[model samples]
Target chain A: MLTLQFLPYSEIEPLSSNSRIRKILNLVRENKIVLMEGRLKPNEETDLIQRTMENLSKDFKGIELCTVYPNVKDKFLKGLLVNILIGDRTGLTVVGPANIVKEIKRDPNKILLLTENVRRKRKK
Target chain B: MIIRLRDFISNVFYKLFQQRKSLKLGIYGPPNAGKTTLANRICRDWIGEEMGSVSKIPHETRNVQQKEKIKIKHKRKELTFNLIDTPGIATKIDYEDFLKFRLPQKEAKKRAKEATKGVIEAIKWLDGMDAVLVVVDATLNPYSQVNLTIIGNLAARNIPVLVVANKIDIRKANIKKVESAFPQYEVVGISAEKGHNVEEFYESLFRLVK
Candidate 1:
């Protein structure tokens, strides 16, 4: 079964950087897709990827991470200012296990998250 | 007279400043993207030495390697910099993947551990780069998240980047796909192992750091 876990920005706002990464990675390692409410700091994103690499195994492949932030192109300076002032809490970050989420494609308007299908037989 | 004198002195200081600072060019990319091969090509051409070894097995370069004080002279233009070849960055590193390459289980596990450290080191070294050459394998899909993340992080840091579409010697190589994937940056296609188009590659580096 596939599970999507929604993590609100407020839930993780007070956590340390390492703790935030750990929280997200732990959920991902459990095969739960994390729908995070804010973008991670650039360094945090790299660190998350680094941590993910360390914990990879046959059962837990890795993760597919993507973020969609709108209006950055329209209001570049304003967005930059907001980002600097209140952290990068303007976008949604999707992190899913690679085995479950086949792909995550983000365009200007929407995100296409493709997942793998699993089938099983039921006993009568 | 004082205005002219001030301008002249400022120009001398600027020239002196430019001469004193050495460039650090970092080669970065995903696993098996020919980063080390390109580094070896550049080093062999200029310093007459290879920086490190290359292998079909991924994560062969599990550490940050550097070759210092290499100078290249092409035509009348000269460029010199410290070259750093970083291990390939990846979101996943399973020891079982190495088993496919016939590596023993214990050795595979050891490589995986070192590879994770390498990824961390590579990301850490990003802060120190003056310019970076992001090499991509032309034969594979260029739209991977790993590529986007690496490029995005570099862009956020405001680092000057040049995309090198490597493995052009292979029949399946598609430079245009790589170019379109990163339309904002200049994409130069070359086969590092075959030494094809390296002259042009050298010319691009001079322009990149200028």
Candidate 2:
């Protein structure tokens, strides 16, 4: 089963965010796929890579990352406000175990289509 | 819910720490392409220490070496990064190739094995790289199979890249060939060994990450 827990961009984007990322890393270690609500800011991205590199081992097979943006079919100011109000409306990121996510191509648009198509196939 | 409270708490913490940070810069190229020469020069200029030793052998740097916290200041802007100097990458590795270099059979095989492992490690390190400097020997034709392979891998990962046309101090060095070969990416010509045009190289590198 694919499971997800939402961690806001606000929580993980801070400079002194090691403990918060540690929390997320622990969840990943337990084989839970995490769906973060927004992109990891630049500094946070660096920290994530550093933390993830340190924790790599057989029991923990690292992670595969993918991101998707919901095409709301709008432009300009409306899009800007919607983005501010609903984080990751710009792009939602999904990180899962490397072994699992590798078989799934790392494309945001195709991820939804593939998941829904699989769900339909299983129901039938 | 706890999620709402957590968001409020994190927002408070976020304000405490935020600033520009360093990038992890990697240097990669084929064997005998002056990769280590460039690595040594960059370190000598910025960190005031050499990152690694350089030799004429095919695979002198058989392991990845790193020098942390290299800060470069040009004009009013400053760029800082953790520098990773990787081994020469090759498509094929045979122990026999080292024998031609006049090494004993036993030592040659050992070096070849280590060099192959180093190549794998360098490619794996790509995932962690924020940007890469592809050092090409300008005295030779830049249209080699190995150079193309390295560029293709960087393109696949979407990592920022800058090609360095090194060895320009040599009589045969031609920057135009290297530039024409990789027109898509910015190419800077410099004689890393002599430190000629090194300031221009530094400026181009800073611009690469910016």
Candidate 3:
């Protein structure tokens, strides 16, 4: 069975970058796709990729991550003022394990998440 | 002594110009995209040497390799820069994947650990580069997330980039696909291994530095 978990920005706001990455990685390892309310910082994303590479093993492959942010260029002044105040919390991030999530293709219009089917054997 | 003073001032300006010519050009792309091959080709063409070793296995280049003071001359136009060939960036790196290449368990794990470090180092070196050669495997899909992320980061920094669609000798190589993927940037197709259309690539380098 496939699972999709939603994590709000507030839930991770208080945590450090490492802690937030760990929390999301744990969910991805369990084969659950995490839909985060806000995107990670740029350095945080690099750290997450490095951490994922370090944790790759037999059962766990890694993660497929992508973020969709609104084009605030159209409203540059308002966007800049709002960013100055609230720290640019305006995007959705998706993280899924590579084993289960075959691919996550995102264009300007929409996202196409493809997954592979795995059959479990019944216990004897 | 006015003539002597003028010569000294001219020498100072010449040194400064030489310093400005030493731009850093980084080669970045996904795994097995022929980055090392291209770096070696560039080095051999100019400096009569090779930069790094190449292998069919992914992550063979698990560290950043650099060749400095490479000068290329084309049609009386010359450009000098430091060439940095970085490890291929990837979202996933499983040690078991290395075992498929017949590597021992211990060796594979060590390679994976070094590869993770290499990826971080490559990203960290981005700030120091003056120009970049974003290498893409012409036979593969050009719209991958890794490619997009690397290009996006460079664009955000307003860095000068020249996309190299490598391996045009292969049957499945499609330069048009890569061109369509990055329409905004200039894409040059070349068989880095076989040395096809490399003269055109060298000419493009002059435009990139400018």
- Sort every candidate by DockQ, greatest first: 3, 1, 2
- Higher-ranked by TM-score: 1 or 2: 1
Please, what are the lDDT tens digits per residue for candidate 2 over residues B50-72? 87788777888989999877888
lDDT string for model 3 (B1-210, tens) is: 999999999999999998888999999998999999999999998999999999999999999998888988899887889899999999987787799999999999999888878888888898899999999999987877788778878887888999999999999999998998788899999999999999999889889887
Judging by DockQ, tell me the better candidate of 2 and 3: 3
Let me know the TM-score candidate 2 reaches against the reference structure: 0.58
Top-down TM-score ranking: 1, 3, 2
Distance from true location, Cα of B152 in model 1, Å: 1.9
Q: Model 3: residues >4 Å from true position, as ranges?
A: A8-23, A37-44, A54-60, A67-92, A105-124, B1-18
Local error of candidate 1 at residue B77 (angstroms): 1.8
Q: Write the per-residue lDDT of candidate 3 for residues A21-97, one digit (tens) a residue.
A: 99999999999999998778766777788788778777787888887788676899998897677655787889999
In model 1 chain A, where is the ten-residue run with the lowest total lDDT?
A115-124
Compose the digit string of candidate 1's lDDT tens values, residues B1-210: 999999999999998877555689999999999999999999888888899999999999999999887888888977778899999988877787799999999999999889988998999999999999999999987876678788988998999999999999999999998988888898999999999999889888988998
lDDT of 3 at A60: 84
lDDT of 1 at A5: 99
What TM-score goes with each of the models? 0.82, 0.58, 0.81
